[model samples]
Target: MSSFLIICKSIHLGNTLKIANEMAKILECKVLEPEKVEAEDIEEAEVIGLGSGIYYGRHHTSIFKLLDKYSFKGKRVFVFYTSAFRKVKFLNGCEDKLLNKLRKHGAEIIGVFQCRGESRLLGGVCKGRPDERDLARAREFAEKLKKKFS
Candidate 1:
């Protein structure tokens, strides 16, 4: 069992998966999609990351459903997401529902990471986002998490 586990869904342009991989590198953990996560994986992880592309103002349905099947009570969690917008203000609402669900389940939110993703809509708005700068920030966030839990 790894000390850290990140359950990620990167259905759009693999944006969320990129961030997940960055964090996984720092934390030395595995990035598993929601469907592939087993009960023991969640149980043994010191921290869990739930993330996906923002769809219709929230995370993918699969992420929410993953929470439905498992409990995060008393567990530490970090939420990450990517969308067409990069500003924190705009990203706030994107994570609200997902964070609210985590709160309701008594999960301790350790941190949040967000960045602009090339939305393959409106003729690919935000293209080239989650570029080098965003990836560096993601690495930094994961390093912080590793130090906090180390």
Candidate 2:
């Protein structure tokens, strides 16, 4: 079986995990929650997926820290995020920033995917997200990942 790893960190309802787990199943990948691993321990995978909960329009601390410690050279990397706002263009910056970072580390960026995650704060603007539609979109992205990296 091909081995892939998904590193996810979240501050809220674990939406990142939910989506990453679903994608992992599709790719037959291993689940590596960064919070539970040493920085060096996460380097064995050939392909890496980073999923994060967008905090203040950026990735959470745990993910940022892991990115700082690990280099992505010669690896296939994909980024997925759940955001509070539905502004399609607003997420472009975040995705670009992540892509830039990965590229700097010599990673082959497969793609960037985003979905609306549940937001209980601020009057529920992003409420009821990672719903069926979001899951379908994520799964589609996962299929693309399989084709590219498999």
The candidate scoring highest on lDDT is 1
Q: Who wins the TM-score comparison?
A: 1
TM-score: model 1 vs. ground truth:
0.94
Per residue, candidate 2 scores C-alpha lDDT tens digits across 1-150 of 346788888667877777888898898877676777665555677778888888876777677667678777888888998887764665546666677777887898877888888877777766677898888888888988887777
Clashing pairs in 2: none
Model 2 stretches with alpha carbons more than 4 Å out: 39-41, 88-92
- RMSD, model 2, all Cα superposed? 2.0
**Local error of candidate 1 at 64, Å?**
0.6
Superposition error at 118 for model 2 (Å): 1.1
Indicate the worst ten consecutive residues by lDDT in candidate 1: 84-93
Measured on C-alpha atoms, candidate 2 has an lDDT of 0.77
Clash number for each model: 0, 0
* Regions of candidate 1 where Cα sits further than 4 Å from its true position: 87-92
Span of ten consecutive residues with least summed lDDT in model 2: 87-96
